[model samples]
Target: MVSTIGRSFNFQPCFLFNSKTVDKSLTARGHSWLWPTAAGVGATAPDRQIRAAAEQRPTWLPGLDPPTYLDGTLAGDYGFDPLGLGEDPESLKWYVQAELVHARFAMLGVLGILVTDLLRVAGISKIPVWFEAGAVKYELANTGTLVIVQLLLMGFAETKRYMDFINPGSQAKDGSFFGLEASLEGLEPGYPGGPLLNPLGLARDIKSAHDWKLKEIKNGRLAMVAILGIFIQASVTHVGPIDNLVEHLSNPWHKTIIQTLASSSS
Candidate 1:
């Protein structure tokens, strides 16, 4: 009887060792065999299948694979090409540059609007409302000539930028005219870094440059949204964003966007 007990104990330990080895192998393959109950089995199959599936899942949209083009090379790319606009490589490059340009413009626009409104609020009566600035009467006698000259200058600059984008490194950087270089040697497509751009050397290294690019894209996106909101608010209320904020602050209950719209409709 003592001999039989010793054999049984040895067999039990060997069986447990094999079971543990099998569990480890399964776990390594993204599976579990610990739970053997009916409910556990029902849950395990789906979970295990998902784990066994391809790893390249979409970040924004669940259960879908990310686009082939969105390999996370761009600064702010999150595989967000729902419309498949950037499927083509060349088109994707152009869109990336275009987005950067638009974002910069949007940031500038939001800054201008907010600053103008804040100045007006601070009793700067000379500063006209941003939306109404176009309609404000100018004191200049030759306004048409000024507009024409401005348009010509802006058109020339924009055309040069566009041509450079189409054929990068084509623009001369001899800096012959007033220390002006149309394109820099080591800058990105839209970013024509010269003595005037980022002169502080904020992005000195590769990692810092990438970090700055990410920050710029994020802030630019937020600025674009803010500018859109400002336009919508201006169109709806016929007032500046700061005025709207002041009204809301003064009377939170009734000065809200929804309440204002309801009252206007009523």
Candidate 2:
């Protein structure tokens, strides 16, 4: 149980997935240029202006197209079975796949803000005492967030379900259910390093209770509490495709990922 439960959490297409997904994502790399970090200058407006200016240069290679990353990953994976083929497929396959996952992973760092809030509210575990004292600790926490974002963007997941890695089970399985609870306990140990609790499952558990009305009516304290908890968690969490400038600049992990994959293509 790592004290930094929420520490390295990120949300990217490939971060939660395995190698196949990573392979697909890398194929979309186009631009290899990186904007070097500048000090003292504002990071927003001038950054945008610089980017716009760079875009006009006809010699510059284009950045990865979103549609390409989205569709490319799928097409490359489906068309060429990298996992089954092993290292037989062209090295370019692995290269593109890695970059794809990396870029998507970088964009997923938006989740860090909420994870930080969660720790501040109710952190799951405590850090080791070796570095728990004052200045070291705060810096460590901030550094952890950056590391988490970096690792996530770099797209190397230790735990990925064969089923979900191939098939994302966003909804409740078994058809009769719209949540994943009955299967929570059965989760492979050490999987994803997260508690298998399902908020949606909790809501579904008491559906038949008191003819559903009483359950949904919020009369029961248990249900009310569960509902409130889910609300607070969701309200604080922002889950969606990343679409912003601040998010793009802070993504150092992805920049390196693309570079590695793009280099492979050559």
Candidate 3:
């Protein structure tokens, strides 16, 4: 009777050795067989939903087109025009170049100071070996001061430019809380100091600006971070506490790179 039952069922001793009939039998059980399929669908659904949400995410500040840089060129075309002393499209290109130059000089000045401090701590007094310690110190001090001033100026100018761009039609309306429409309770959309100053619009612009800044940092400014990282690493290795906060604030990849290079060379 057992042999007849076995013959009727085509049973395999191990799951690994199960035949098509067993699989078919399992599928015939319905809910139990569908569990894994359901689980897989459930697992993938969230990811698909997330992607769809990202795709559908609305962008504010719709009309602004921020300049992009590639290979030290504005939109991969224009060259150096640091003073913005050009005409039309050239003026726009020069603005980008000037911004880049300003950033570069600022980074250079900061790195120079940090590196010099590191060198001094390491008993390497002067960089050239010919210049007096006093002279090198004086040079660095003056240069750092000048660069810092330039950086501050550039920052102020850039902020003004950005503010103008974001609130082109009416700066007073968009940025300030207490604008002309703020007094009017019945002000409608598309009017100056009306919907522009409303919570939703302000939130959208703020979010857009935040995203734009993030994109700028992620894309064009990595080299600045990396160059600054070298200074941080040098300070950490030799000078100690001075760059500790900077090292902590900066990404771990820089530290990893510095350590790996040190190890490989040693």
Measured by lDDT, the strongest candidate is 1
Off by over 4 Å in 3: 1-152, 168-221, 237-266
lDDT of 3 at 233: 56
Model 1, range 1-266, lDDT digits (tens) per residue?
00111111211112334454555565556554453323334246675454334244334444343464676667886667656777788888888888888899999999999998999988976688899887666878466777898899989867877877887766645652344664243365676665467576556454448778989999999998999999988888888998999999999987898997887678
> What are the clashing pairs of model 3?
none
Residue lDDT tens for model 3, 128-216: 32113334545445867867988999887466445544454343454343454353222211222235335454323432354543443
lDDT of 3: 0.42
Query: What lDDT would each prediction earn against the true structure?
Result: 0.68, 0.35, 0.42
**What TM-score would every model get versus the actual structure?**
0.73, 0.19, 0.25
Error of 3 at 5 (Å): 56
**Global CA lDDT computed for model 2:** 0.35
TM-score of candidate 1 to 2 decimals: 0.73
The clash number for model 1 is 0
Where does candidate 3 have its weakest 10-residue lDDT segment?
1-10
**Which wins on lDDT, candidate 1 or candidate 2?**
1
Which residue pairs clash within candidate 1? none
Best by TM-score: 1
Q: Which lDDT tens digits does candidate 2 get at residues 1-266?
A: 00112221222232344544434433346321221223212236675565454345322124311211122222222122223333333554444444444433333332343344344434453432211222353643686687688778544332233234344452225542334335553222212211455434343433233343222222332333443443443343332112112243577666443563464558
